[model samples]
Structure formats: C-alpha cells, structure tokens
Target: MFKVKVYVTLRESVLDPQGNAVKGSLNSLSYTEVQDVRIGKYMELILEKSDREVEETVKEMCEKLLVNTVIEDYRYEIEEVVAQ
Candidate 1:
C-alpha cells in the first residue's frame, strides 16, 4: 500500500484572509513575536498498489480536485506502508 501526504497552501501572490485573521488574533493575545501566519490544508490518501505511477496520479488529483491551481500550490509525499 502507499500513503500519500498532500499539503495545500495559498500561492504567495494570493492574499490569505484566514491566516491574517489568525495572526491578528494572536497578536491581540500579546503574541507579538509572530511576523506572519499562513493557513494550509493537509490531507492523507491511502492508495492501493496499481499500474499507474504514484507521482503522476497524485499530481493529476491535485490539479483536478485536491487543490485550486490558480490560487493554491500543493506538494505531496508518498510512503510505502504495510497493510495491517
């Protein structure tokens, strides 16, 4: 089996309102040391061994549904796992 770890984040050129909100809250709570905050999405997908290339499949999934290509960027790690 393979385990895929996907991380999605807003593009640097895009504004992250949610992250800004969190940062603002933190600052108000006297956490002034923080310079910036960026929120992202983490996802795990378990995929059975298949004929398709893992990297290609993951990239297709990300570009098609897992992430917004225009505004978000994503990367993934694939690990082999023993099924219990």
Candidate 2:
C-alpha cells in the first residue's frame, strides 16, 4: 500500500482571485505585514501496491486530471504504508 500527497497551485505568472481576496481582507483587518497570499489545493490518495512504478502513475494522474498545467504547477510526495 502507499499514500500520495499532492499539492497544486497557480503558477507565479498567473493571477489568483481567491488569494487576492484573502490578502485584501487581511490588509483591511490591520494585517499590513502580509504582503502576499497564495492559495493551493492539497489531496491525498491511497492505493494498493502495483507492479507499475507509483511515481510514474501519480505523475500521469496529476498531469491529466489533478492539475491544469497551463496556469498551475503541481508537486507530490509518496510514502510507504507501514503495517501496524
């Protein structure tokens, strides 16, 4: 078994409206020190062991469905499931 952690976020060159809204609210609430705010998505997946490489499978999933490559970038971590 394995556990996968995926993180997806807008590219630096892209605009993030939600992040901007949060930043604006923080500034309004006297949080001027907050210069920038960016929001992202975190996901987890559990799967049975397979003969195929987990890293390659996960990368394909991210590129095809989990992330929008045009305006977003993604990264992931994989951890082995230890038996209790």
Candidate 3:
C-alpha cells in the first residue's frame, strides 16, 4: 500500500484574503509576531499499489486533474506501508 500527502497553496503573486483575516485576528489577540499568513489545502490519498512507477503516475494524475498549477502549487509525498 502507498500513502500520498498533497498540499496545495496559492502562488505568492496571489492575494489570500482568508489568510489576511486570520493574521488580523491574531494581531488583535496580541500575537504581534505573526505576519503574512497564507491559506492552503491539504489532502491525503491512499493508493492500492506499491510500485514506484504507479506512485509516480498517481502523482502526475493529482497534479494534472486535482490541482490548478496556474495559480496554485502542489507537492506530494509517497510512503510505503506495511501490510496488516
């Protein structure tokens, strides 16, 4: 079995209003050190195959269909799991 962790985030050129709101709230709460917060999405995918080739293929599928590469960046990590 294989596990894939995907993180999708907006590019630096894009403005994140939600992130800015969170940062503002943090500042109001006296957390002055927090600055420039960015919001993103996280996803975990479980793949039934263990082959490295299959894993690469799955990663490509995610990049092409699941994520929008024009305005967002995505990264994924694959891990092998022991059978139960």
Candidate 4:
C-alpha cells in the first residue's frame, strides 16, 4: 500500500483574499510578526500500488486535472506503507 500527501496552493502572483483576511485578523490580535499568510488545500490519498511509474502517473494526474497550473501550484509525496 502507498499513502500520498497532496498540497495545493495559489501561485505567488495571485492575490489570496482568504489569506489576507486571516492576516488582518492576526494583526488585529497583536500578532504583528505574521506576514503574507496564505491558505492552501491538503489532501491524502491511498493507493494499492507501490511503483515508481504509478507514482509519477499520479503526480501527472494531479498537475493535469486536480490542479490549475495557471493560478495554483501542487505537490505530492508518496510513501510505502509497511504492514505490521
């Protein structure tokens, strides 16, 4: 078995209103050290296969269908799960 962790975030060039809102709240709370706070999505997937080719294919699927390259950036890591 394999476990995958996916992270999707907006590109740096794009403005994130949600993130800005969080930053504003933080600042209002006297958290002045917080700057450029950005929010992203996290996903976990489990696959039955543990092959290098399959991992690459899943990554490509994320880039092509799961993520919008123009505005969002995505990265995924796959790890083999050992049974006890």
Point to the candidate with the largest TM-score: 1
Candidate 2, after superposition: displacement of residue 79 in Å? 0.5
Residues 1-84, model 4: lDDT tens digits: 788888999999999999999999999999999987999999888777658576787777787888888999988888888755
lDDT of 2 by residue, 1-84 (tens): 889999999999999999999999999999999999999999999867672788889999999999999999999989989756
Q: TM-score of the candidate numbered 4?
A: 0.87
Ranking by TM-score: 1, 2, 4, 3
- The 10-residue segment with the lowest total lDDT in model 3: 50-59
Off by over 4 Å in 4: none
Give model 2's TM-score versus the native structure. 0.91
Q: Kindly report which residue pairs in candidate 3 clash with one another.
A: none
Instruction: State residue 35's C-alpha deviation in candidate 2, in Å.
Output: 0.5
Per-prediction TM-score, please? 0.94, 0.91, 0.87, 0.87
Q: Please provide, for model 1 over 1-84, each residue's C-alpha lDDT reduced to its tens digit, 9 standing for 90 to 100.
A: 899999999999999999999999999999999889999999999988663678888899999999999999998999988889
